[model samples]
Target: MAYDVQSAKTWSPGDNAFYLIVEGTTQEEIKEYWEQLITDGEILQPLAPSQWSPLYGMLKHQFGVVWALSVLNDASPM
Candidate 1:
């Protein structure tokens, strides 16, 4: 079987590893995306409000690797 390497809203492929970052003005969008990922069995972790903040959360899907997600209050850094 072929392994599928997918990423949740917060996850991305970089640094030779999979990382998740849920930021920007799309917290709700990201949450919905994550919900879909869970429903699809792509993610094995439940997202908790405390995982990151009331505004966001971070988690690794299927591997407990690590990911970051949160509300984007400021964009000056970018």
Candidate 2:
């Protein structure tokens, strides 16, 4: 599927408020993504177990877009 592209003023890295959410089925998968991000992008936060509810972590994409990745395990109440 194709989507429309909008033209706007370019923003500096970590300047925009928009972010992305990437969901996975396991912590390993999330870790893999984190590793890839570290190699290609930047790590906003290290890949560690979340202190709150379900297991999750946040990182910045290669294009400066923030990504909140999570593992939706069955053990999670949510």
What's the true lDDT of residue 48 in model 1?
51
Instruction: Give the number of the best model, judged by TM-score.
Output: 2
Candidate 1: Cα lDDT at 62? 49
Best by lDDT: 2
lDDT of 2 by residue, 46-70 (tens): 6666754255776766776677787
For each candidate in turn, the TM-score is 0.42, 0.60
| Deviation in Å, model 1, residue 43 alpha carbon | 9.2
Report the C-alpha lDDT of model 1 over 1-78, residue by residue, as the tens digit.
112245544434552155456554665776775664444244334455543344555445444445555555544233
Clashing pairs in 1: 10-20, 10-21, 11-20, 22-69, 22-70
Residue 68, candidate 2: alpha-carbon lDDT:
74
